[model samples]
Target: MPAFEALQTVPRSGELVDKAFSRAARAGRAKEGIEAQESMLITAANILSDNLENVVTNWPDFDTVDPFYRELADAVCRDTEGVPGVDALRQNLSEVGWASRQIDELRSEYQGRIRRSGPDTARKVRKQAFARFADICDEVEDDLLALGEAREALKTLPDIRADEPAIVVAGYPNVGKSSFVNHVTNARNETASYPFTTTQIRVGHLTRERIRYQLVDTPGLLDQPADERNAIEQQAVSALTHLADAVLFVLDASGDCGYPIGAQLELRDELRERFAGAAAADEDAVPIVTVCNKSDRSRGIEADAYMSVTEDENVSGVLDLVVEAVGHEPELPFDG
Candidate 1:
């Protein structure tokens, strides 16, 4: 559930135009001669203008959006085929806004013309207004279609709260990241697929001292290097950079996760360097807790913490280290 969850389904241009005209025709039928023409013109224009404005207003302003959500949205948009990028989305919204204003102007202009004309001429003026409305909708048909695609692509984003302190659980495949999260957090973990990627991420929550924490496990997105990633994957990694308060880089030093310990550490180094640049620029150093999972099999490598998820060996201790590294204070209801 992203901020885009609130977005209403965008109507196709032809569908919207047809609905407005059908309703306008009903309004016209209820009146007589010039009044009927005037009624139809007003009804059609209002319907088009209001609906277009609603579409534009429903979208969050990308510039002001929380960086986590903004980056997530951008990634989703970029990965989606035929869907435009964030800048294009903003431009489409601007075009829609302009169309709404243009419709209002056309309504006023044609209403004047209809008022000055005789009954027969009034009908012609209304017809002209209807033509213009149809043309305007046609002009933005692609923009509307792009918006609809964006909505479908973005609406499925995992409902990770940007306001909450988030701990990203990252590592190579089969590193026990999800298992660790499930073991520590009693909350149900949600699995969601990112657009265009086979990768699915898990989000879980835990509360300590009444402070809720979000645990995110991105399987494919954060499991590798920036150089190995496509543009869309890099954008998704950027989203995590904004969302994470701290990172738990799981490592299976026992070589049970298919990847060798050295390779795993290399990935860890890549991630550390990635976060370091972000932390420096933002002035918030995201601490990486190297967790050696499957300690029962082999705790061959040195790490900040060691855990065996299946056997429940030092699992809680590992969580304690993560929470401490996050260092987020619980909000007090009353000031001292």
Candidate 2:
């Protein structure tokens, strides 16, 4: 098997296998547990090898293995039927996966270290491997935690901007916030055709006839709690509060914003509350311009008394309406 060949070539495979078995024994699965782990490892290796061989033999395009090893590890952890010391087995399997990944990383490092240090490399490689393994484990944990935090932040974010003459151009990421920005302004900003392409806020100035206004292309806000937003995303949202003359809330009519229209509207209401002051302070609040973008897509939530458009539709019509909504443009550019 290709996986077996790769495993055998690893200088520390024996040590890794021994350590895995030892951990399993300590976890009170000395008898069947060790054998089960070894069998699983061998099976995974063979499957991986077969998949690799197919890819190599095919030369160009190849199908990837279904149920990748990480998924297999998760499955193993969840299984408890007929397996003695099931918890121990799960832990052992996870450890084996870790060891396998570590071995692969070490092998790559060894090549680089050997080239730099010549023949006297064994001791340094061992020390470096230990440090690298610990670092990788810590990094994995930190990333998982950060992802959790980001999800929570996304949830807490308010959705609607009721009072602000704000125009939010929200849609599934990469659905043309930046493109719309370019169309409205002479400013050139990066516009890419990929998800999460705009990681930062890009604001531009747009002038049509005698009216001058600011348009902001905000970072993609997924339907999640506020605590779940990453630092960059939070900053992007914050930037909106600071620079927004009026919000052009953009929505990609074609893509899912991960929630129903009601939920999005609720979020918008929450945003209005958060950014706009109490009912008594309504006069100081900003007005929102709800835009349903990507008109090319037949699907769109009917915006309430606000402007909406498709991919082929120009925003100039909406802009004129917005100018009227906010009353005549200020004689001078908005000082705020």
Candidate 3:
């Protein structure tokens, strides 16, 4: 995943103002006469403009990211009105930059006066410019704060590839979803031991011959009504709906997943319906395979709807089914 470290690292508006002022003051101290005062005001305005603009420019256009990431972003970051997050940020950034340029204009307006006046009067005008700079930064403090929050939320997104054959491992919490992920992919010990224990998405990979499949673990998304899930969980839904090429709906026949067989089945039915509906609605439905797990246990449960895999840690057949469903051809049939 592309990291939002640049957004997270944007300095507070006050910090930028202070840095600009201090740097300008140093430059002024280096020069002599009215030129020093002129240098101070001009440099400060430029710094304020550059720093604030940089903050705006560093943010990626969230609306235009890959489907998985864009949907995930919509889930994590609150969208305003019908406007997308990136558009809103772009608007705020424009305002911030315009205000910065106003500061430059302020410096320009004072240039003639500073050039004509003595050092004392020039110093007073410079102070006035600084004050206006402070006020301008103060005005955009809320915008800065909003950007920071969005960036913070964006940091939690996983690194699942949107273009690959994504195998979204979904089921009720703790149904050996993560364990199965570890079995098939590079993720070992990447999952938790309890229900709702894995909050964010966990990602791994499986490569057979030359083909690679992306494996994703969505924790809080699979076992609930779609309307009832919060925004955070909805992010998982977006990924599953828009990004997944196929889904691995894990079933806990041993009843160790905390939900009863009936409850699990109910959730499964809902998910099946939802997946079918989404695919039909968009004509991009992803195929799902049910894998009955925990065969090592003696719960005496049965899931006869699809293939079954026991605790022996072999899922090559399931992987082959996934590949075939997603329309990918292995160099050879999966023999793992």
Q: Judged by TM-score, which candidate is best?
A: 1
Each candidate: what lDDT?
Answer: 0.88, 0.42, 0.72
lDDT of 3 by residue, 84-151 (tens): 55566666777777876787788778887788889778888878878988999999987887677777
* TM match of model 3 to true structure: 0.83
Quick one: best lDDT, which candidate?
A: 1
Candidates sorted by lDDT, best first: 1, 3, 2
In candidate 1, stretches whose alpha carbon ends up further than 4 angstroms from where it belongs are: 79-84, 333-336
The pairs that clash in candidate 1 are none
For residues 126-185, could you state the per-residue lDDT of candidate 2 as single tens digits? 345444544543433432332223223322222222222334444335545666767767
User: By the TM-score metric, which is better: model 1 or model 3?
Assistant: 1
> What lDDT does model 2 reach?
0.42
Residue 143 alpha-carbon offset, candidate 1, angstroms: 0.6
Score candidate 3 by lDDT. Answer: 0.72
Write the residue-wise lDDT of candidate 1 on 1-336 in tens digits: 467788889999999899999999999999999999999999999999999999999998888878877887777775246343677798889999999999999999999999999987999889989999999999999889989988987888788887789999999989999899998887578888877677678999999888899999988888877787877788889878888999999999888789988888999998888887788887887999999999999989999988899999999999899999999986669976
